[model samples]
Target chain A: MEEGKGEVKHMLLAKFKEEVSEQQIEDCIKQYANLVNLIPSMKSFRWGRDVSQENLHQGITHVFESTFESTQGVAEYLSHPDHEAYGNILRPLLEKAITVDYHPTPVQL
Target chain B: MEEGKGEVKHMLLAKFKEEVSEQQIEDCIKQYANLVNLIPSMKSFRWGRDVSQENLHQGITHVFESTFESTQGVAEYLSHPDHEAYGNILRPLLEKAITVDYHPTPVQL
Candidate 1:
């Protein structure tokens, strides 16, 4: 694929602190999802709570996956003022957070 | 959504041992991706390397995402012989692995 042309999946794995309430996490997720609307490059957003039977989550309870048309779109979303604002609301409640971005490659075999 | 009717994304985050060769990891990923073809419930497979500028990954180097039609489909995949076989090939090369599954919910806001 051409540079910055492939689809990128931005994955955020978060584990809320024990003291954080469910309502706060819910509110944080809602705002995080709204970034899709606030930033044009953020094409779509979806999220989920951990549901695996496998004891391999390493305490990460929430997974937020967002799609961008290209890496540039992700960079734009990352630096956008709205994301910064959302982070301010989210940072205090998190026990840990991990973010990964990639240009998804399809496997035919 | 009705029980087992929504889509489920199974995300695997892996960090290979320092001693593992690059080719070994590549082979492992290719085998993992091919599980889509081996297991009927595994609807699609895609993967990517960490490209995030942020240092939040906590050692996760690769992300493998597989989509299933429903939770039941994922349960079926978990017990499939092919996945078990793939696991045998993958587990030994990894220093750490985290797997999480979720039925992705769209954010309306």
Candidate 2:
């Protein structure tokens, strides 16, 4: 981790292919979330389906966020064998995947 | 809020226009974060610039996240006068803005 940079978050905005069944998407989500168990460095995970009323999503429909203690930890999770295996099941189903990693800085009042 | 739904999070993926100065972007971020103070229902706010090595951000360079207690709370923040005022400053600086709101569900390991 860079000095003074805190927890890193990996956020994925997924727009699955229209032909991919809902069941397939559910399985993909489960596999993606279960990486927390398979990889020790992944601190936590959460996911959500897009429910925005504003039409500004640009076709991204689901958001998955994973937290890590450091950027190095995130690197580990990204390259872990289990993650690669999960990607095999996930990558084909996605029409587009937008990933962004960042060191979260809280805005205090 | 929906019957079983918990907190709602608003995630924004922003790619600023090339001509927008860094100082202008910083001012926009400060103004966006300060909305937490002006709006009663906005629970918390945080932001980060992308540092992903996988090169899948789809041109989104920054992510800003805001949390609300309920979906209605998010709606209140969306329609709030203060947020609209801030958007006037932020919208023009962006080349693309992807907004997503979701009810966060933790993935228990």
Candidate 3:
């Protein structure tokens, strides 16, 4: 975790289209993981398919979490060509999507 | 960033009650953060308030992300006494809440 550098998190929660297979979702996630390696402004990226049967998710079935150096980093990631390409591939498969971004302050217990 | 240990992510996104002040929300987030330091199974925890005016979020105001060693680690964190206490404080303040948990797989683009 990088401290005091205006760290921000970008998160996505989505449900896949009924026709989208599990393997396709895995492929899409891998594509996103690869973007982290290529994007210097992205501090960290992790994604996963929902494995829980819990009611708390309200139908959300997958999640992607990424930490960027700052809001600017977030903008750069959003506009990056690779991200655009990935989004094109992902959009059709997403039945529903929600995104949230925030600046993370250190939590001192 | 632990590898090959059945890493799982737990995420929460919520909107606060109409009367809940921003400071109260921040305080609640800090309490949750402190639990990370106390819980042996919680590998990492980070949180922030939604800074975007983007329509994508659909009213969700905050997010919390935590990584655990495995599903068991997640169960342990959920059942911890500190978590229960914190939830009691949080539940009343939340107008809406959504949680998602998943086992993260490495994305090999």
Docking quality (DockQ) for each candidate: 0.61, 0.57, 0.53
Candidate 1 vs candidate 2: which has greater TM-score?
2
Model 2 bad stretches (over 4 Å): A1-4, B1-4
TM-score of chain A of each: 0.91, 0.91, 0.85
Candidate 2: tens digits of C-alpha lDDT, residues A60-100: 88888899998899889889999989888888888988899
Ranking by TM-score: 2, 1, 3
Q: How accurate is candidate 2 locally (lDDT)?
A: 0.84
Error of 3 at B70 (Å): 1.8
How many steric clashes does model 3 contain? Answer: 0
Candidate achieving higher DockQ, 1 or 2: 1
User: For residues B23-73, could you state the per-residue lDDT of candidate 2 as single tens digits?
Assistant: 887777878888988999998888888888788988888889898898889
What C-alpha lDDT, on a 0 to 100 scale, does residue A101 get in candidate 1? 87
Select the stronger candidate by DockQ from 1 and 3.
1
Pick the TM-score winner.
2
Candidate 1, CAPRI quality class derived from DockQ: medium
